[model samples]
Target: MSGGVDSSVAALLLKRAGYDVVGVFMRNWTEPDAAGRCSAEEDFADVRRVAEAIGIPYYAVNLEAAYREKVFAYFLEEYRRGRTPNPDVMCNREIKFGDFIEEALKLGADFVAMGHYARVRREGGRVLLLRGVDAAKDQSYFLHQLSQAQLSRALFPIGALTKAEVRRIAREAGLATADKKDSTGICFIGERDFRQFLKTFLPAQPGEIVNVDDGRVLGRHEGLMYYTHGQRHGLGIGGGFGPGPWFVAEKDLVHNRLYVAAGRDHPALFATALLAEDVRWIAGAPPDRVFRATAKFRYRQPDRPVEVEVLDERRAFVRFEAPERAITPGQSVVFYDGEICLGGGVIDRVRRPYFEARRSAFGDVFDRVLL
Candidate 1:
């Protein structure tokens, strides 16, 4: 349940709907806090108490081994290659919808449920994923990896309710997590001081921060892995009494360098076409031709108009009608047609006119390593 207000209310809603419910707290990882870091033991305790109050059997299932191989390992690999990884999306795919669902089935439960704000439905004998009614908190992007089988057996009771309504439901039900703050960062991984977390796994590879327009050194960074796309602060480059702030333009993984510029007006961050791989469709098949839809590159971004064309079974190309900034490789690009989630994949490349010119200049190596 993650000891969150949403999940607790979801369980209560399911219980009232006459479903035989069992509260499960999946233990994905137990991070040893560094000298001054804090743990979330109390959060687990709170989840346990809520389970007791609901009179449902609760159990902690350890998924650490699977999490390491499937989620954490991928996360490390992505960063090592200078790409931002979404661990939550991988966790939902590999551990939650995969292993956790298997465990639930073994326990003879008819459905496995979670706090995700999304909907599931069956149409023409196939399961379809839908966006949550609460657009502000819709989590279908993270859930894009779920198969039709998983969708059929999953329950998202809070899908139709807003966050405010969820809190009210929890309070009226006398749930302990009624007023609990939303858990941030990676679940079970605790609140990460991100730079500190990277230092633990990736060795300090000090590099220069250069200007994208001119290859002039501006500052230095421990490693490119510590930074992400669209970051404006902590560049270590002092733009004292300037008219504007600097934003990260690029991270050269091979040369171990970062590029920054002191303006947000640059077109470098904007993308017209995004190429995605590691494709997973709810129906296990790709649609033919270009399909008009709406897509969101990140979880919080509003889904905007796009055209998705399947390049192959394993790859698809998404072209935004207008440029979307910071279309980072390794992040997801989830497609939706109305409320139904068409599915999504990992962003492998951004197709821009300038990028094409650079690719032509550098040849195949540029295409292979830019991601």
Candidate 2:
């Protein structure tokens, strides 16, 4: 349980169904915040209260070491390479379903259940992952990397219910977490400034912020790690430049420079195709030689039509039917056929719409080209 209304209601529903429900809270991060407060302790306290109110036994398992080695190490490495990585996707794959499943089985459990907003179906001797009933809260995008084996042993008790329905169930049961606010953003960086938290691990290196269109230096950036593509707010580029604001277009790691475009619809922010590596297909193999499917470049993004070509077992080339803005590298591109989440991979590269124009204008600015 996550000490939230959804998980609390999930446990209550399972118990009401006459199943032997045991609440297991995984303590993933234990580091204290800047105020020297441990959020996990407060969350676990809520978990205990909910478990006692529901009359089910509960236990807390420490998985901090495994999380650090498996999920967090990759998160830091991706930032070091100037790529924005999704640690939640990796945490679900590596820690939650991977290590947490093993820990559950050791406790004599047949199935491991979570409060994920997704569903699983068994058909034709195959396990299929499906989007939750709540369209606005569907989380199948984050669970796209799950395997057949993981889905087979997993259960999502609250997948069929909406967020309001979940809170209602919790309130009816008199659960303590019925009115608890849902957690947002990265779990490790709770209530703290993201750039400040990141700087605790990765030292900030100041660099020049360059305007990609005219090759003019606009300002100095704190660090390339603190910015992301399509980010407009923190560019530090004030007025008098043009009639508009600026957005981060690209990161020139080799030159230690950050590139920005003047407008939101700048060509530098859009891409036509992307190359993904370390791909995984839920069906355990690739599909046809070339096939049309829908994919999400990021979580909660509407699925877009794409023609996927399998380059190898671990790589695929995806071309979007239309240009997509900020098709970032190091993020996962999840594929889907209707409600079925096929699988996903880490975005290794992108083919920008203004590649030729930037090359001609900036010459060797992007030596390590993302084109």
Candidate 3:
């Protein structure tokens, strides 16, 4: 719940529905701030206030060691390997539904309820995961990795309400978190500077920022670990070929070099195909080996038409209808058949154009593209 209005309202709704409602705030991160205080403590205080206002029994479960081992350790490892893994997806799969659900059942819980902006329903004796009614706040992407058993025991109370309506409900109920700002991004790091925070764990090794289009070393980068695909800010690059801003096209982990491009529309940033590994289908089984669907490589990306060919048990190739820009490895590519999420996987690598695989600036792979 993290002491937010959404979760507070979730508890209220559950209690109203005649269900035994208990609020549990899991303490997964214990990283101390510069002031020698754990931010989770402040969040726990807010949880307590919210729980009291909602008139429910609340408890704070310590999951720091488990989170460090399962989620945080893998997050650092991915960065070290030059991949930007989405910790939020892994956190939902490992922590929220894994250890936390186990704890809930031990307390004789029939099911676990969350404030996630997603929906679940039972259709033909199978529980289905669906997008939230709020299009702008739909979180089915992060919830894509959830398994059938997990979805069966999960409940989302705020799935139908808009963000504004959620706040209004909290205010009407006189909940303390009524006006609380929604927490964005990863929860562990909060609002800390990413590079400075990462330095505590991974010592940055400065490398030459090389231009990808032309073999030109423009400037020195702080570290490859601090950068990701299509990043333009905080790169410390200046005075290139023209009065220009350079974007991070790629990170050469082998050479420890950061590749930069002249502009956002650089050809090197686009990819027509990608290989996805570590796939998880929410339906407890993969869909057809070869199927056409819409996919989103990043959370903010619109669903683009794609043709997926499942290769093995947990691998597949996705050919996007249009060339995707900066299809970074280690990010999840969620596929959907219309509004129903078809599930997806981690991007292992992306395939761009060479001489034999050239594409036009408008994303046409050949001289003529089919309508």
Candidate 4:
């Protein structure tokens, strides 16, 4: 329980079902926030209270070292390479299901449960990952990388319920975290400014912010790492050029340049194809060498029709039926067949129409083609 209503309700539901539930809070980040306040300690306190109220034993297991080596290192490395990485995805795979499961098994636990808004089903001697009943809060995208073994030992008690129902259950049970606000953004970063928080690890390397359309130098950027594809608000590119606001269209790591587009719907902000590497299929292999399915480029994004071709074991090429906005690199592109989450992979490259048109002029600098 992360001192939240969702997990408290999950534990409550499991206990009510006559399952022996033990609350194990994995302490991943030990460092205090900018205000010198330790959020983990506060969260654990809530966890302890809820465990007591639910009549179950609870323990806090420190996984800081494992998280830093496995998840945090990869997060910084991706940003250093000018790609925005989703650390939460790695956190779920490496820390939550990976290390946390091992720890739970050591305690003679048969299955490890989490508060994630996702589900699993056993069919034909195979474990299948499924999206939660709450379409708006479905987190199967984050858990897509999990393997069959992990899914087999995983239980999501509240996957069939909506967020409102979760809060209602917690309140009715008199749980301490019934009204607690759900945590958002990167877990370690908390409510702090993302750009400022990233700066603590990656020092700002001031670079030029150039408009992709006209090549006009708009403003100075602190660093390409501070921006992401399709971001608009923080560009600081004041009005004068056009009626539309400036949006980050791409990052040129070779030149240390941040590329911007004038409008939100600019072609530079959309992509029809992408190449993903380090692919992990939950079923241990792709359904076929080529198949059609629905995919999500990021969490909370509505599913889109796509055609996927498995080039090899660790890579796949994806073609979207319609243009996808801000198909950012380093983000997981989760694939699904109906309710079944097939798997996902890290977005390695994208094919944008605006960039393709200028590829001849820019030479290899704009070449992100995978075909």
The candidate, 1 or 4, that scores higher on lDDT is 4
lDDT of each: 0.81, 0.89, 0.83, 0.90
TM-score of each: 0.93, 0.97, 0.93, 0.97
Q: Give lDDT tens digits, candidate 4, residues 72-144.
A: 9999999988888989989989989999999999999999988999999999989999999999999999999
- The lowest-lDDT stretch of 10 consecutive residues in candidate 1 is 362-371
Model 2 scores worst on lDDT over the 10 consecutive residues at 362-371
Q: List the residue pairs that clash in candidate 2.
A: none
Candidate 4 Cα lDDT to native: 0.90
- 1 versus 2: better lDDT goes to: 2
TM-score of 2: 0.97
For candidate 2, write residues 113-181 as lDDT tens digits: 889889999999988889999988998888888888988998999999999999988888899998999
Off by over 4 Å in 1: 35-40, 240-244, 357-365, 369-371
Candidate 1, 1-371: lDDT as tens digits: 87888888888888888888899887777765554444445667878888888888887888889989999999989988889999988998888989998888888888888999988887799988889999889999899988888888888999999999999988888889999888778754466677887777878798988776656777788788888877887877775625447787667776787876567866656668878999888777765567888888999788799988898877988878997777788899888778888889998877755456565543453465343
